[model samples]
Target: MCAASLPDTATFPFETAVVAGVGLIGGSVALGLRQRLLARRVIGYDANPEVLREAQALGVVDEIRTSPGEWLRAADLVVLASPMRTLSPLARDLAPFLSPAALVTDVGSVKSGITAEMEALGVRQFVAGHPMAGSERGGVTHARAALLENAVWVLTPGDHTPLTALSRARTLVEALGAAPVVMPPDAHDALVATISHLPYLASLALTHMVARDERLSLLAAGGFRDLTRVASGDPRMSRDMVVENKAALRGALARFRRQLERLEADLDDPEELLAAAAEGKRTRDSLPVVKRSLLPPKHDLVVAVPDQPNQIGAVTQALGASGVNIKDIEVLAIREEGGALRLGLESPEEVSRAAEILRAEGFEVRGRG
Candidate 1:
């Protein structure tokens, strides 16, 4: 799939690029590099030969290797996209083969430990990176180059990291349609601990709490499903992330506990509770809207569809035929007989076009701009 467009004058910077893992994130990195013409050649390495084979067959890479070898000597850019736990050992394994001038980066969620270890290993050009984008689904088969489009990609370079290397890293991130954010490794870990790790733990705990009774589970609604979605992610990866960043996560947990304690103490004070709820709503509403590069903010079109087979397909196919691309979507409500789908479109014009097309096809369309 195509990513958000880059400028016409964008240059291909690397002669050869290597992705050390051919999983979802790695495959996406390879595809993005190839699709954007950022690398003249994309090479892939994975511990799993089957994955490498799949990635090659899927055209995610120009060539595949089961292990690091002299092949890496040609790489000017290398992405460590393996699981967090494997990064350290993987770095050491590939270090001997890496070129002295190659720019190294990783997609590990937790950064402090990996960055320190990579630096200790004498990786002179290391740039710690984490893309704030992924899916619950895993594997190269589900990978999409556009997954990183408009996503925030954090880069954490150590104090000794070379400026040239960091600049190339930022260029790579931007060329792939991601926004590059620079921050220290420790700060990155601390922030993600609160925003990312803590949420996964909460989702897990909530899921376990609600799953104890079959009766209660049957009654669970959309809110419960949405809140607990992270619990359904790859559990092993989640476990590694929480455990790896336990210190910061514990800090986040304590802060959350304090908030909960305060809410409990305010149980008899409706006014205080109302004030807290209002502040939360206000803060959430004030968050920035997603923009496609320099384009205007996206708009939504909610379409009502019947439970009849292929209804969802019909709506999307109609829009596809009209060249309307849905930026995002959510099923607002569903029942045995029908459901409401909220489709996020690229522009107000697309919303209007989609609304007209769906209405002509007899679907109930709402929320058009």
Candidate 2:
């Protein structure tokens, strides 16, 4: 699921990459590609001329093209960042234009429907990928290059998917500073229905209920604001996501309804209420403490730690001596002799500094050019 240190190749992973839409997700990808020097040329295409112009002005893309076919024809990697409804038609339209060696992927939240459509359309070298990172804000103006850092980017590669094509996509994902995870399309859809799609609906419904009771607004505080955060996302995108994944959403809602009824029935049972509270606490504790990938970014430095003594501590101490801060450090692999540590820093500059310091300290460091 993880890349072996950013493809250690002489040539760039891709020659030309075209992002279909220059909105938040697409813009972020383009920014990462350009910032990491992962692609030689990165062009963007958008139907809205004004937004396209804005994206170009913001330096989100190197070039802006009016015709998708022309750019797609020249691209070796294409990312479909457009809305869900537009994905199917675009796949069919771009199928003929996409080069035989091209690898196409998407950032859509839903996957089952899109994967099936692309498979049917005969799009060459297509991989379904979804980056588990975003903001409530929309538009290229809000995009950041570090949007994919430390995020669990899921790639749904089926039996027919080419291993080399998936490797190319993973190269791009790793360059974006995100971990690539593989799964089946149907399983991905089913899982997101609970973790991704269901939560947004719950927030929307909770906000609506609060709005109906104007008195509740006066009592709304930290808890209410935190619960309704996702409800403030772009309406168009949220509507498209819920509608496209309605089948899974329906099942999630039905199960949620049963849970709600059970809670209602337990209103008079103190023991049941205590048990429910304990269960909620356990679930919350079991969940990973996810960090948002957009701000401050995440830069990693990988080093092979020697087994004996305080090698890990010595590495950190060297960086600490120079006043560099560490965000989150993960042990990538362990062995009887030692282990490989992936040190997460606040920015690319910090990554460079840490690598230099580690190398001076006689550590074999390999990460982030």
Candidate 3:
């Protein structure tokens, strides 16, 4: 059954949940569980004491442990939230102390290799999971429980993975307000390679191309910035992500190269370029109308604000007070004198309400209908 079909619960599913690697994803999971009351007590384990301390201070976790020990014996669920490369080693290190009933999972984007390694290590009740929600920023400071809200979380169970364990995973994922889709590990890796990893690599390449030319740097505007935003995310984590799934990433890269070659060959022909651009826009517009994807086919509005203090904050606060939800917000352009902010709402009603609210707050608003 899919996560949507799973019955929602008002009671805690796990008594003591241990999250090893209290980084952004890990910390978010910890915070979500505690905030939703999915776990009675959430314990954090991290290699860095500073991160554990920070997590506790931020109320991301109820308790912090320096290392995995007998404390894990009490954990009903264990989340391996470290870097992709470190997951295997970390699992092996904690294997001795993990309780037989504890359900183990990871939030890493890549799943095929680590799933195999975990199974080989004889980890009891291991299920592969990847939450398609996160920011490029890393660390507990940037972690928020809302990151998992309405996200697509994939779960890949190995051959020996029991139905009970998978059920438990789906329950937890749904409890965290994420939709869970179950698929094979290989399938999940291949899908993310093209959509997630390729985008990051493409953004990185674009940023590098612009950085090499000093004059181009100043000319880089909204479009360039929008295309390369992912390039500014945590480089270390991104490196591990692309490298961990290199086999699938290489395949994706080949497909992307073919597209680039076609574009390059047609650059001199205005008609062919226009055709490509039109088709590209059509395909982009057809993306799944979900929370993290395209935001319901873009109920977009642009607000013009002068270069003054609290301009952006005032606009958002006004919308908030009026019960208008902003699905996506972007700074289209900013100049010395003024700038434009693009906001994506859920529907035409929201868009209309938001524009009227912003106008009342003394901002020039326009919709891209």
Candidate 4:
């Protein structure tokens, strides 16, 4: 990998960012960057003029351009947030115009094809990134500032990728309040194929199987409904994803089929099937639960408040009044004496400010170490 100079701050390296595609991922990225004050300017380019207009009107992007080539020439960073199928062609189209010093990345779920395309395009500073975050909803309208919070953003830098650009990509993800995890492109694709792509396919199949059956719809219960909920995702996006990552998805499906066959064979033997089910439960239970926030609070602040209907709201208002942005707040414990509300802030300084403000307002406050 080529090494370049590391920037002191992630935000310092990228003065301007051009986002291609104004869908959910692209819009959310632009929004996140703006929210965190990461870039000086963010321009967007989308095939659909309406989507581009919507992004600009919603403040998801600072400006809209007709072509990426026009904006990418001067951009410090170019983020491709389009569907998987468009990634390769987009890479090819943007490669010649990309600034040599600029870092290029994408939000495509599949990486191998894009990596190959980048290689063919002779793009040396490219980094493959996939943010493991999304909602059931699609488009720029559904963009959320906190969408990437606590989410794992994977970076797969190829052999020719510059170390400077890799560091920049990590810094960019951090600025968005996301954890950057590095993995090989192939491995990332294979893992996601099982955890993400395969699940979507299964959900799609489950929903279709039931919908096509005349009797199954009436018999469907909460379990079926809940399991197949993701099937309602954008059909075009889903279709593109499945077709784009066919190899990995097919391999995952084969393994899943084998497992299902094994379970079917043991179904007649209740004891064997029961043991298998127990083993599966054990494995599932052993998996660690990922916290919702990538940047969790280092310390917990416990505040004692009077047991009242609006005590929590009062405490929050006091903190806000003191210019302390509460990261999280929850009612820890409630009693007749006073209820203990825990507030999670970004840093100890914010905690101190909140505590002082709450105390000044005549509420007992304690900062937990």
Native-vs-model 1 lDDT?
Answer: 0.86
Tell me the tens digit of each residue's lDDT in model 4 across 1-369. Answer: 001123435434458888988888899898887777777678898878999999988888888887656557788889998877887777777788888877889998888788778877887778999998888778899987688887989999887778987888999998888899998888887898898789898898888787667788887765676667778778888888878888988999999999999999999988999999999989964544344565557556888877578988898898787788877676552222226777877777777877788889999888853
Sorted by lDDT (best first), the order is 1, 3, 2, 4
Better of 1 and 2 by TM-score: 1
- State the RMSD for candidate 3: 5.7
Q: Which regions in candidate 3 have their CA more than 4 angstroms from the true location?
A: 1-11, 268-272, 288-297, 302-325, 331-341, 354-369
For residues 117-176, could you state the per-residue lDDT of candidate 1 as single tens digits?
987899898999999878767899988888888888999988888899889899999999
The TM-scores, one per candidate, come to 0.81, 0.73, 0.81, 0.73
Clashes of 3: 0
Alpha-carbon RMSD to native, per candidate: 5.1, 11.9, 5.7, 9.1
Report the lDDT of model 4 for residue 341: 79
Q: For candidate 3, lDDT tens digit of each residue in 292-365? A: 64235477888987988988899899999999988888776543222888788888888888889888888899
Off by over 4 Å in 2: 1-10, 293-369
lDDT of 3 at 284: 76
Say which prediction, candidate 3 or candidate 4, comes out ahead on lDDT: 3
lDDT of 2 by residue, 39-82 (tens): 77788887788888998888888788866565577799899998
The list of candidate 4 runs beyond 4 A from truth reads 1-11, 287-369
Q: Output the TM-score of candidate 4.
A: 0.73
Q: Which residue pairs come into collision in candidate 1? A: none
